[model samples]
Target: MELKTLSEIDIISASTSKINQVDFENLTFGNVFTDHMLVCDFENGAWQKPVIKPYEPFMIDPSAKVFHYGQAIFEGMKAYKDTHDDVWLFRPDENFHRFNKSASRMAMPEVPEDVFMGGLHKLLEIEKNWVKKGKGNTLYIRPFMIATGHGVIAAPSSEYRFMIILSPARAYYSGEVKVIIAEHFSRAANGGIGAAKAAGNYSAQFYPTKLANEKGFQQIIWTDDATHTKLEEAGTMNVFFRINDTLFTAPTSERILDGVTRKSVIELAKRENINVEVRSVLVDELIAAAKDGSLKEIFGAGTAAVINPIVGFSYKDTYYELPKIENSMALEIKEKLTNIQYKLAEDTFGWTVKI
Candidate 1:
């Protein structure tokens, strides 16, 4: 499909702004949207011109493939506003490349750069006011595609809709998190779409996560599907374990997400002369490390939470509590990442994209 130029995009401005109604301090994550959004339709063997319009709902036939067979993919990233009110996006190119990688896996058409990145810049330009300026405050950006064909016969749809929406969000996870090791439920299997940010990949874990919540755990640390012995990741974030000052995280594959925050933390650790191991982290090693008093920290990294520190984890029938150590690596990494995102510190890695 041929890409459309920026001049070809259609714009429909909102009649009124809702900025006055929003409480910048007390925002429900992802519940409040900006005044506008971006949408592009794919049909007739090509993608049409992208459109930026007021935030409003549009109808789709019940037979849409996304509703029936779940032909959908999405990416999560954030936009930050500095004290000087300059807007920034962290490594959006990674999200753009990953979005198309997910589309190819799902048999969906790739959204062109002009449509994805171009529309993103245009939409943010229109709603730049929604980006809050402060630590732990940013505009949550969701870019997703859905199967919109009228006929859903248990197959991929011929038509698709790619859209981007901006939501206001504050810091997520106010307190320390507790998790359970998944010895039974699996998030994704071998040769599957686990690595892709498909909607189903997340929805599939809802029930298991609910069960863990029932057991008083906030989330689940999913393991390998076949063995359930090697720890893969935590809910929504890539999992990391610090044992005796060495950071260990599972290598990304078909079953694990290649998280942007996870990679950045690894690079940061290397810069600080800390050891990082990118390999399969076995549950047994973690348990043994806990017994030997070497398991110092566990944390989750992603675009949403930035860095979520896990205080405890359960395995088999026993739970282990991580020690409350001073000068935590998790907090340091979070500060570094958020500082760069907010333009407070030098963006040494050149990860920030200014809007």
Candidate 2:
């Protein structure tokens, strides 16, 4: 039987609200979810109309392709509520484009724009109360797809399930982060799915990242897979190295994720007349700059943290401390981006989309 088409779609909403029971003050990032979700199924070479219903678990066979072949991808974005009682999303179009790119690379069908954006708007409109108006509070949106057909086959599944869930979130990281350079392990390779936000990309970093955590480092700056000598990304964020007055970051390749916040910061810096260099950032050059006191700042940028400063870094078991400068570029960029995100200032780049 064929699935229902998009034209006949009528979103099914949740019956009750969970806003009062939520502890807004004690949010632990993605741990707490909202009351509703959006789900759409892909089958028979067509995507069905999406449904917005109460958040609950769905069952899948143990031999699903997502389980056997890891055909899964997800995107993280946020919806903010300003003091003016309006809800807004930051660069959602970018997320939508990237999600399809990831799906293509993972051999999964793309989610239709209507199902992704329309369903998102409907769900957020109904759950608008969960978006608390404050400095750090916002709704963390997670959109993901998975292969759902039952089989132990190594090929891609014929059926897929796309879901979008919301979680009230605060700051992802509370303090300055300390990082360790990855000298032994690699995060992604030249022709890998690293740039695609595929689900397996993160799981590959767990063991090495755990070892870094044991050494008192909060994250790892992964290097190129070929030599493990050039810096690519810091943990889950794209990294930046500020030497003297120039900002440097590794160009995005198949091994690096094209981070939205990273691109925004580059644009923001260029507009401020800062020289931004996009190229390969070598580990040796970074250590040399650190030794000569030329490395002023090291930070990571992404959708979740926005901008995370690195207080120190470890290489070859030797720790180097970075000075706390008041005029750091990371802080400057973060303030500007946050202001635009929270509606505290004018959005010169037209980045925020009101809901």
Model 1, span 66-155: residue lDDT tens: 998999999999999999998999999889999999999999999999899889988998999999888988999999999999784787
Q: Which window of 10 residues has the lowest lDDT sum in candidate 2?
A: 1-10
CA lDDT scores, all candidates in order: 0.91, 0.89
Question: Candidate 1 — which residues are off by over 4 angstroms?
Answer: 1-5
Top TM-score hit: 1
- Can you write out model 2's per-residue Cα lDDT over 1-355, one digit (the tens) per residue? 1111234456666677778889999888888888889889999999987787889888888988998899999999999999898999988888989999999999999998878887788788888998999878889999999999889878989999999999999988877699999999999878889999999999999999999989888899999877888999975899999999999999998989999999999988998898999998899998999999999999999988879999999999999999779799999989888888999989889898888
- Which regions in candidate 2 have their CA more than 4 angstroms from the true location? 1-8
TM-score of predicted structure 1:
0.98
User: Candidate 2's error at 20, in angstroms?
Assistant: 1.3
**What TM-score, computed on C-alpha atoms, does each candidate reach?**
0.98, 0.96
Clashes of each: 0, 0
User: After TM-score superposition, what is the CA distance of residue 48 in candidate 2 from its true location, in Å?
Assistant: 0.7
Clashing pairs in 2: none
